[model samples]
Target: MAVTRRQMLAGSGAAIVLSGAVDRLFAGTAEAAQAGGRSGYGPLVPDPAGVLDLPRGFRYTILSREGEPLRSGEGPVPSHFDGMAAFRSDGGRVRLVRNHENRVTAKYRVPAIERVTYDPQGLGGCTALEVTSGGRVLSERVAIAGTAVNCAGGPTPWGAWLTCEETEDRAGTNGYTRDHGFIFEVDPRGRRTDPEPLTAMGRFQHEAIAVDPRTGTVYETEDAFDKPFGLFYRFLPKRPRGGFGTLQAGGRLEALRVPGVPDLSAIQEPGTVFEHVEWVKVPDPLAAQTPVRLQDFGKGGITHAQKLEGCYWGGDRVYFVSSFARSRDGSAADHFGQVWSYEPSRRRLTLHVVFGPDTDVQAPGDSPDNICLAPQGGLMLCEDGDGAQHVFGVTRRGTVYPMARNRQNIGTDQAPAWGEFAGVTFSPDGRTMFVNVYEPGTTFAITGPW
Candidate 1:
């Protein structure tokens, strides 16, 4: 909640020089914090750009890009595309459900995911695609109809797409409906216009979702705009072991609060940085309509993370990354980079990885957005920034490597880059990879060696 002078300048889109200052701030700081051992390995390449770069033989190709036409006759998809998931329908065909984070000027073109084409009438876009092993689009359709600004989402075990809207407007402005902040369930194989919004998921500025199949609990994160002090949430379905199909049955949504940092209102002030943060749980998430004040959930002395972005569930824990927790305020807390792992079994969360704010592993804006576990167990991250945006990989030993860049140049893509490299996931067999790009509005099939 605290904002600094530099943040003020950046917020106002003013010009300033903090690169040198930021560089000095990171130098020698890694070893100082290490004490005895290394934190993790740095990025694999000095700088990987435009094309996909893997270990010797791995390669990638664009399956679909924003604005591309669908086989079902839909005109094209829109911008602000975020997260996605990969699935198999026919013999070797893969299906993908992708999100779009559109705003005022942005609007959905037509239905394409479920293969039905219809005029979007200014609505934002979310699509599903059927592609081949070689990255060829066989069919594409809109999964959820009549929704806009669709952000990051998670795939349900029952084969449904949980599409989330990132706006809070009860009645959306810019011609979008008021249903902007809700979650919707779309049949990945149905017609684009067939489903209804799944209001069970608490409406807010939802950023991403991760599902715990063991408990049937849906973990979600909200993106707060001004000096982000958002909350993480968990939705328990009404049915004891329900999921996907039961979303409409309704359930309970709980907000994540850091244990200490007693006062969030204090961080609301300008030029101040939140410190001594811990995690606390808030009973209700929808209570505060405007800039919801989330409880701190961390205990002991831990750096507070502001904007909670990309998340993935693997092994016994759920991993999440914080983009831009540092750099804004001079406070050396959750800056640099961080990866937090939550162990549902023991109900404990631990810090997994921390990178220097200005280090090569971390993106310049701290916008290391979407994440996915690689076949070998490391993590693959999409850097969310302009020109410099590229896909980076993190090994189990914590080695970072730039895999590819968005040279296709979709207009208005999110940095660390949004849209194209935005959402990435491997198939069950780990032989095929699917990526969703927002701007040029496309989804691609990436296949090669491992």
Candidate 2:
């Protein structure tokens, strides 16, 4: 049975009836419905701080700024802060493990230590920041170093951040001495440990990851914008809940497939659901020469999407973002982005939201990157498109509304230097939310009524 917009607006009960035993993860809220039905968190107001503009009644605190010396005295905080995750610490403080999306040519690099460094020449990794419950920064230090393009990753149920590299740059290339494109674990509590790449997770252009807490299965997304695109993958660990090194020891990597659907481009349409999906094992998890998506394509059992990014686990499904997919590599019929929800229990994937192509920043077609389940019971998305970027709130009824915007300017010229919002996540207690501005690299702690 196919789910429709009308059915979604009818309520969660109707959704349950229509989809059988499948859970209605995105059921609409009364507050969302009251705000003109399907409209977002209301209009965004200008910021007095000259950094971010938020909705009325909401305020932001700049926790960490880029180009400053680290609190731990390693070096200046690395720039290009990308994906991040928040965790509760011992003394009413929150710990954040942030990714630095730097490459070999980056001017700054996170200082590398012998034990935790993967490749000294690799200029990307993660940093740990400790902040009080009141949003005051306590300390900052390099958590994992000597990696390439540490883009986005997720927190494990066992309490650690899985930092992913969004690069396929191999060893001996671009001044790199070791292989790139792997995920590394970092302890959020600033514990000392060796950094090891989980080779069994399948090396590719890893964009983001979401682990199913119930199964300990890690679902990964790849960001490949060029031909052959990327595949949605899952790593089944050898042991369900082993210590830190379980993923590194070994695992089976598989790609998602929708039984009879040869190509998944049909998912570009809103509310399209692919039922009864299956997994195709990768011939070589570590594709040293060939990419993993290509390996899945050669086997003829897997389907791929263009530029898969930003995924999170919520309710009983894994919600993932596909940033701008087209019929062909350069086709005009391109979707700015599409949000898909995958139900592991039922082995199904549903296209929850699809954005049409529109150049207007305020339009509904804005490309979405990072995503998280809102404490108010919906989804919060980080816009990564042309012109001004925004953080959009999608209600259970599928209405999109702007929640925050970047109003940072360039020098005295007053030219807008729009920065894409990344690493949107709420604190464990849900009292605060943490997000990052891609350029100039700033982390903000936002608090307000939901």
RMSD of 2: 6.4
Report every candidate's CA lDDT. Answer: 0.55, 0.76
Put down candidate 2 lDDT per residue, 361-404, tens digits, no spaces: 23342668988876656667787866567776665655556677
Task: State in Å the error of residue 307, model 1.
Answer: 1.9
lDDT of 1 by residue, 298-343 (tens): 3432223466677667755566666655434433253545556565
Question: What residue pairs clash in candidate 2, if any at all?
Answer: 40-401
How much lDDT does candidate 1 score? 0.55
**Where does model 1 exceed 4 Å of error?**
1-56, 112-122, 191-195, 262-291, 294-304, 327-334, 358-366, 409-420
TM-score (C-alpha) between model 1 and the true structure? 0.74
Worst 10 contiguous positions by lDDT, candidate 2: 13-22
